[model samples]
Target: MKITTIGLGYIGLPTSIMFATSNHQVLGVDANANVIDTLNNGYIHIEEEGLQKLYNNALKAQNFKASLTPDYSDAFIIAVPTPNNDDAQKSCDLSYVKSAVRSILPYLQAGNLVIIESTIAPRTTEDVISPMIEATGFTIGEDIYLAHCPERVLPGNIAYELVHNPRIIGGVTEACTKAVKELYLTLVKGELIESSASEAELSKLMENTFRDVNIALANELAKIGTDLNINALKVIEMANRHPRVNLHAPGPGVGGHCLAVDPYFVAAASPHLSPLIQTARKINTSMPAFVVNSVERLMASAPNKKITVFGLTYKGNIDDTRESPAKEISLMLQHAGFDVTEYDPHANKNEIMIEQACEDSSLLLVLTDHSEFTTIPETATDRMSRAHILDTKMIVKNCGDNVKLLNLGNMHQSLNKIVQEV
Candidate 1:
C-alpha cells in the first residue's frame, strides 16, 4: 500500500510511520517545511515513546518520507487537529483538513482511498470533505473512496495504541469501509468495526464524551466533598468496591486534548439534544475557578504565602499540557496574589515558566501526579520552609508533622473530624 498522510502532528506522524514500517511506501505531508526536513533526517518533531525508533527504522528502510506538498498515492489518511472554535460551540476549526484535501485534490486519481483519521463532527466526511474533493471534477465513490476512521491513540502511547486499539471505519459506501478496513488490517492488531461515516464520527465523540461525563461526575463530587469536609477519594474508593460502581478520580479538572475537547464537537451539532454532555463540559470548565477559590481560602490565613505547584502537564507521565487543568489552576493561583512555582519531570521545554516560582514558595500544591514530584529529596524540601502541601491529584503518600496536607478527596477521616471541630 502506498499511503500519504496529511498533517504530520501527533497523530499523523505516528500513523504514517506505523504503515511505513509495515512495508508500505508512506509519504507524510505537512505544511511545515522544517518538520518535513527534520523527519527526512530520521528525527521526530513530536515526543512519543518508541516513535524515534520507528522513525529511524522507516527512514533507514527508505519506506517513509515527508513533504510540504501532497503527492498522488494509493491511499490518503487525514489526521489533522480539529480544535473547538471560540463561540463555546463544538465546531471544528477545519482549516487544516480543508487545506490538506485541497492540496491532495490535484493529485487524487481513481480508486484512491481517502481515510479521515481526524476527529470530526458527524457527516463531515460525506457532506463537507467529499464535496470538496469532488469539486476537482473527480467522480466520488468510483474515482475516490472516502471514509472516516478516527484515530484513538493516546499521545504518549501512540505507537502502542496505534496497533493495539480497535479501529472504527465508517465509509460513504460499503466498499469504501471494506477497503479502509483491509488497509488497516495489515497494521492494526485490533478489530475494525464497520459503520457509516457519520456513525463512526459520532462513535469517537461518544467514547470521549462518556469519559468527560464520568470525570465531570467525579469533579462534582469532589466539590461537594470539599464543602462537606469529607474525603472524596475515600468515598469513591468505598463505592468502587461494589464491583458495578466505578468512579474516576477528580483533579483540578479534565485536561488533555481529546477528553477536554471532543465532547464539544458532538454538543455543537445537537446542543438541544445532549444536555448532560453540555453540563459536563460546563462543570469541567468551572473547575479551575473552584480550585482558585480553594487556594484563596487557604491563603487567607497564611497571608502572602508562596505556593509551589508541582506538575504542569495535563496528566501524569505525559508532557503534553493542552487544555491542562494544572496550567489553569496555576494561572488562577498566580492571579490571586500567591507566588506560584511549578515542576514537571516530563516538561523540559520550560513551557509553563514555574521553575523560579517553585524555588521561593511557602506552599506546595500538587496539581499534577508526575512521578518525579513523588520522590522529592528531603534536602530539596528543607530549602522551601517545609511549606503546607495541597495534594490535588492525591499523589502524595505520607506527610510529615511539619507539612499540612490538603487533598481534593479526604483520604483520612480524622482530617474531616478535625475540620468539623474547627
Candidate 2:
C-alpha cells in the first residue's frame, strides 16, 4: 500500500521509516526543505538508535521517499506537532495538525484511511478533525476511515519499540477502528487495543501526565530530603522495595515534547478538575530554579564562577532539546553572572572530551544521565580547579578522592561546609 506521512519530525520520520521497511510504499512530507533534501539524499536529520540503518534499508528497498507536500495514497498519517497555545489555559494548538490534514485534502479518496498520531486534547478527532474532513465532502467513517493512533515509544530505542510496543487504535466508528488496525498490523508485533478516538487521545496524554505527576512527587521528596539533610535517592530506593511503591527519580526538570507539554493539554480541558496535574506541572517547572539555587549555595565560596555542564538534552543520548531544563538553567546561570561551558556530546559536532571541558572550571555539573557519564576520566577530575562536581542526575558514582562528589543524596552535607577545601 502507498502511504503518505505528513510532518517528517522525530515521530513522523520514524513511523514513515517503519512503514517503508514493512513492505509499504511511503512518502514523507514536511514543510522544511532542508529535511526533505536530507532524506532524499539518503540521510536523516534526527538522532535515534538504529534509525539511520533502517532508513538505509528503506532506501535500498526503494519503498520510501520524502517531499514538501502530500501525495495520493491509500493511507495518510498526520504526525505533526501539537504545541501548547499561548493562552491562559495553555490549550493544545492544533494548527500544525489541521494544516497537515488540509494539505492532504486534495489527495483524499473514498476508502482511504486517515490516522492522527500526534498527541492531542481529548475529543479532537471526534470534534475538530472530523469536521475538517467532512467539509471536504467525505463522511468520516464511511468515506475516509479516521482514527487516533498515538505512538507509544521511547526516543533512544524508538525503532525497536515501534515493532514491540502495544498500540492504541481509537476510531470514530467501529469500522474506522478495524480499518486502522488492519493497516498497522504490518509493523506492530505487540497487541493492538481498540477504542474510540477521544479515548485514545486522553490515554496518550494521561500516560505522560502520570509520569509527570510521579516525577513531581519525586522532586518534592528531593526538596524535603535536602532541607532535612536526608538522602532522597536512598529514601526512594528503600521505599520502592514495597511492591506497590514505584517512585520516579527527580531531575533538573521535565523536558521533551511529550511529558512537559501533554499534561497542560489535559489540564486545559478541565482546569478546575486538574489541580493535582497543575500542581505537578508547577513543581516540575520550578526544578531549574531549584538546581540553580543549589549551585549558588555550593559555589558561594569558590574561587571562580566557572561551571562546566556535561549534558543538555532532556534525557540522555538524544539530540532533542525541545523544552530542556539544561537550556533554562544555563540561561539562569549566565544571567546570575556565572561563566558556563556546555558540552553536549550527543548534540555537538565534537566528541566528549571531559578533560577539556573541565579544564580551569570551578566545578562540573552533570545534568543528563548519558551512558558515557557513568564514570569520569581521572584526568577530567584532576583538571577542575576546585575539584568538585554536582551531578543532579546522579549518574556518576565517585570522581576519586581528590574531587568532591555531590549528588542529590548529599548536596545538603556539602552545602553546610562553605569552605569546602577543594
Candidate 3:
C-alpha cells in the first residue's frame, strides 16, 4: 500500500516509518516545513528507541518520503495531536484532525482507505469525520472507506508494539471495517478486532482513563497517608501480595500525552456521569502542588534555597515532555522563590552536568525514573551544601547515607514532624 500519513510528530513519524519499512510506500506529511526537510534529508526529529535506525532502513528500501502536502495514495492515515480545548468541558480541539482530513480530500480516490490513528472522543469518527469525508461527494464504504484505528504503542517500544499489538478498527460501516482491515494486513501482526467507530473511540479513551483513575486512587492514598502518618508504598506493596489487589504507585503527578489528558475526553463527553473521572483529574493535577508544599516543608531548615531537579521528561528514558508534571513542579518551585537547576542528562539537550546542577544546592529533587538515577555521583553529592534527596518516582536506590533521602514511602513519618519544626 502507498500510504500518505499526515502529521509527523512522535506518533505520526514513527507510524510513517513503520509502514514504509514494512514493504509499503509511505509519504509522510507535516505542516512544519522544518520537519519535512529534516526527514527528507535522512534524519528524524523525534526520539524513539529504534526509530532513527528504522527510518534509515525505510530510506534504504526507497519506500519512504516526506512532504509538506498530501498526495494521492492507496491509504491515508491521520496521526495528529488532539490537545485539550475548553476549561469547562475539557473537550479535544479537533481542528488539526479536521484540517488533516480536509487536506487529503483533494487526493482521495475510489477504494482508498482513510484511517484516523489519532485518539478521539466517542462518535467523532461517525458524527464528526464522516460528514467531512462525505463533503468530497464520495460516499463512505463505497467510494472511500473510513475507520478510527488509534495507535496503541508505548513511545519507547513503538516498533515492536505496532506490529504485535492487537488493533481496534472501528469502521463507520461494515464495508469500511473490512476495507480498513485489509489495509492494516500489510504490517500489523496482532489480531484486528472489528467494531463500530464510536466503540473504538470510547475504548481508546477508556484505556487511558482506567489507568488515570487507578493512578488517582494511588495519589489519593499517598495524600491520606501523609495526613494519617502511614507508609503508603509499604501498604500498597503488602496489599498487592494478595491475588487480585494490584495498586499503582504514587508520584509527583501523572503526565504524558495519554494518562494525564485522555480521561478528560471521557469526562467531557458526559460530565454528569463522569464525576469519578473528573475528580481523578483534579487529584492528579493537585499532586504537583502537594510536592511543592512538601518541598517547602522539608527545606525549612536548609542552609540555602538552591535546589537541583533531576529529569523533566514525563517518564524516564524518553525526551517527550508533553504535559510533564516534572516541568510543572520545577516551575512551581521556582515561583516559590527557590533557585532551581534542571538536569535531565537524557533530555534537555544534556544542558547541565549533574555536578554543575547540584553545585552548592541544598536539595536534589528526582522526578522521572531514569535508569541513570539509580546512583548519584559522589562528586555531585559532595558539592551540595546540605545533601538531601527527594525521589518522587522512587527509582533512586542508592544515594549514600551522606545524603538524606525522602520518598513517598517514608514521607509521612517525617511530614508532620517537618511541618512542626517549620
In order of listing, the candidates' clash counts read 7, 0, 0
* Local distance difference test, each candidate: 0.82, 0.93, 0.91
RMSD of each: 2.7, 1.6, 1.0
For model 3, residues 1-422, the per-residue Cα lDDT tens digits are 89999999988988888888889999999999999899889998987898999999999999999999999899999999999996887798899999999999999999999999998888999999999989879999999999999889887899999999999999999999999998788889999999999999999999999999999999999998887888889989999999999999999999998998889989999999999999999999999999999999878888999989998999988999899999999999999999999999667774877889899999999999988999998899999999889899999988877988889878766667767775
lDDT of 1 by residue, 10-60 (tens): 789889999999999999988889998898876998768888998888988
Per-prediction TM-score = 0.93, 0.98, 0.98
List clashing residue pairs in candidate 2.
Answer: none
Which of the two, 1 or 2, has more TM-score?
A: 2
Off by over 4 Å in 3: none
lDDT (Cα, 0-100) at 362 in candidate 1: 64
Where is the poorest 10-residue window by lDDT in model 3? Answer: 413-422
Please write out the lDDT profile of model 2 over residues 64-139, one tens digit for every residue.
Answer: 9999989899999999999999998789999999999999999999999999999999999999999999998999
